[model samples]
Each structure stands twice: as structure tokens, then as C-alpha cells.
Target chain A: GAGVSQTPSNKVTEKGKYVELRCDPISGHTALYWYRQSLGQGPEFLIYFQGTGAADDSGLPNDRFFAVRPEGSVSTLKIQRTERGDSAVYLCASSSGLGRNEQFFGPGTRLTVL
Target chain B: AQTVTQSQPEMSVQEAETVTLSCTYDTSESDYYLFWYKQPPSRQMILVIRQEAYKQQNATENRFSVNFQKAAKSFSLKISDSQLGDAAMYFCAYRFNQGGKLIFGQGTELSVKP
Candidate 1:
């Protein structure tokens, strides 16, 4: 079975630009999550969705960050006016959403803001 | 807020030897989950092992196991008969039993030497 997958393994953009990272969770997964990982650091939570609606968005750093999962499937993390501080790897994960099930993660998309 | 800590920034172990990576966390919730994830240079996060806070018995997966001390707020990963394939960055993560986001530690870079 295919695990979570992210698109554009690497992306580079200038500051103030806008970018979108996409994630395709495993089929039949009811829970989806996004996380940001800085250099030499572990991943920090961003947002989580359960069946198309976000269950938690408190981990989003600022208003510039937003994510959505439509049709209870694919998800996208959008950043407005990207900053150099946003340069990090964006990771996507999915789980069965049943009783503390383990999450399956993707390779992650590395975003670089110059 | 929950926090996880991995004091060891790096650790090296000889092949076929045993190695333990330390992790500690602070949380008020009695029921939660702890996980160890391995990230290779490929940047893929893979589940190593998981321990439920309510489960007094530790969790084990093949050569990988966890020593979970709920009262001490400690969770450590022990790898026996380590192999070269085990070389990677290990992260300790925590999530509530309610299931939302994950709080991760700084990570421990493990190197396996022959």
C-alpha cells in the first residue's frame, strides 16, 4: 500500500512570495496532519484534519499559514508572503483515527525562502 | 502544553551491539502516547515503536523496544543487535489519548559503525 506522499520534493522562492505544499494521505485514512521541521530540529505540528474539517490549527505559527483538506482526502498547506523563517521541511502524515493508531508519514517537501 | 526532550544530540553504536536513546516529557494528561520515529537522510519519518501511557507493559518491535516510565515521564528506545540500516535521526514524540497533534523532541542522530 502507498504511504503518504508529498509533491514538489523541493521548492525555492523569494521572500514575500506565496507557495502551496500538497499532501496525499494514505487511502482510507481519516486523519491527516501537517508539521514543519527546521534544520537540525524535530518536526513541529501545524494543523490536523479529521474528515475534511480541521480538528486543530493551534500549531500554526501565524496567520500567514493555513491548511485545508477538502473531500476528506488530499490536503494543502498554503503560506502567504513567505518569510525566510518559513524555510523548512513540511511533513504530512495520516492515521486511521481509531484509538491511538500510529501515524504514517511522507518524505516531506523542503521549502526554501530566500 | 506538552514538551518532549531528547538530551542526547548524537549517539554511535557498533554493529550487533546494543544502544539506548533517552527521552523525557512533561505532560499533565494521564492518558497519552509516546512514539519513536526514525528519519533517514531520505527525510522519511518511519515509526520505530510506540508505548501507550496506560499500558504498563512496554512496547517492542523486533529488535526495537521502549522502556516507558510513565511516573518518571521518561521513555527510552533500546535497539539490540544494531545494524547499519538503523543509522538515522531518531525523534521522540508525544500525543494525547484524545489524539490531535504531536510534540516532538530535538532528535538524536544515531550512527552505526561496523
Candidate 2:
């Protein structure tokens, strides 16, 4: 079975540049999630999407972070004016939308803002 | 807000020995899910085990098992016969029944010695 996958395993950008990270969840998964993990720390929730709508985006640190899952299958996390503080590994996960269903995670995109 | 805590930052165990990782979470919600995830050097987050707050019985998966104490708000993972492949960062996470976001604890790095 195909697992969750993220594009550009590593991305390095300038302090003020824009970057986009993509995630392809498992087929038929209706619940998608995004998280940011810093070194030596656990993954922090960023956003969650159910179907084509974002059910939660409160975890996003600031307005600079935005994500979209327009068609309900693939998702894109966009960052505007990336900052050095934004450097971290961005992880994506997906589940079957059932309560208590396990979330399968992607390899993640390591974003480094220089 | 819910918070998960992993007091041990690092732990080491000889191969084939058992090692336990402790995790405690603070949450007002009665119904929620607890999870233990492993991240190897590959940086892929793999689900280790899960426990439901409502279930009194602990959850076990192969060499991985969890001692889930809802009353104590404690969830610990015990790895039996730890292998070198088990060396990784272990994280404890929590999610409500509504499944909006996951609150994660600072990871515990485990090293398996030969």
C-alpha cells in the first residue's frame, strides 16, 4: 500500500523567501494533518483537514503559515516570508477519518530557513 | 490546553533487555487517545502503540506494549527485547475523541547497545 509522502525531502530557503511543502496522503484517507517538529522535541500540531475543508488551523504559529487541501486528496503547506525561526521538519499524516484510527505519517520535509 | 510530558530526555539499554519510557499528560477531557510513536534516524514517524482512555486494558503490539493508567494520567511504553533497530526518538501524543489536534510531549531518545 502507498503511504503518506512529502515532496522535497529537504528544502533550504532564504530568510525572506517563500516555500511550499507538499504531502500526498494514503489513498482514501479523509483526514489529513500537518505538524512541525523541532530538534529534540515532539511534533507540534499545525493544522488538520477533513475532506476538502480545514477543520482546525489554530496550531499554525502565525499568519505566515497556510495550508490547503482543495481536492481532498493532496495538501500543500505554504509559508510566506520564511524566517530563521521557521526552520524545522514538517510532517504530514493521514487517517481514515474514523475515531481512534491510527494516523500514518510521511517521511517529512526538512525546511531550513537560512 | 492539553500537555504531554516525557521526563526522560535520553535512555540507553543493552540489546535484548527491556526498557520503559514514561509519559504523563494533563487533560481535562475524559475521553481521548494516547499514542507512542517512534522516529528512527530515517526521520519517519512510525506508530508504536496506542491506548484509549476508556479501555482499562493496556495495548500491546509485538515487542511494544503500553501501561495506560487513566486515573494517574500516566502512559508508559515498554519495549521487550530491545534491538538496535529500536534506537530512535520516542514520542507520546494525545488526541481528543473529536480528533482535532494532537498534543505531543518532548521526545525521549533511546539507544540500544550491543
Q: CA shift at A88, candidate 2, in angstroms? A: 0.4
lDDT of 2 at B26: 96
Cα lDDT tens digits, model 1, A6-105, are 9989999999999999999999999999999999999999999999999999999999999989899999999999999999999999999945798999
Clashing pairs in 2: none
Residue A95 C-alpha lDDT in model 1? 93
For candidate 1, give the DockQ.
0.81
| Candidate 2: fraction of native contacts reproduced | 0.82
lDDT per residue (tens digit) for residues A3-65 in model 2: 999999999999999999999999999999999999878999999999999999999999999
Stretches of candidate 2 off by over 4 Å are none
Give the local distance difference test score of model 1. Answer: 0.95
Weakest 10 consecutive residues of candidate 1 chain B by summed lDDT? B94-103
| Model 1, total clashes | 0
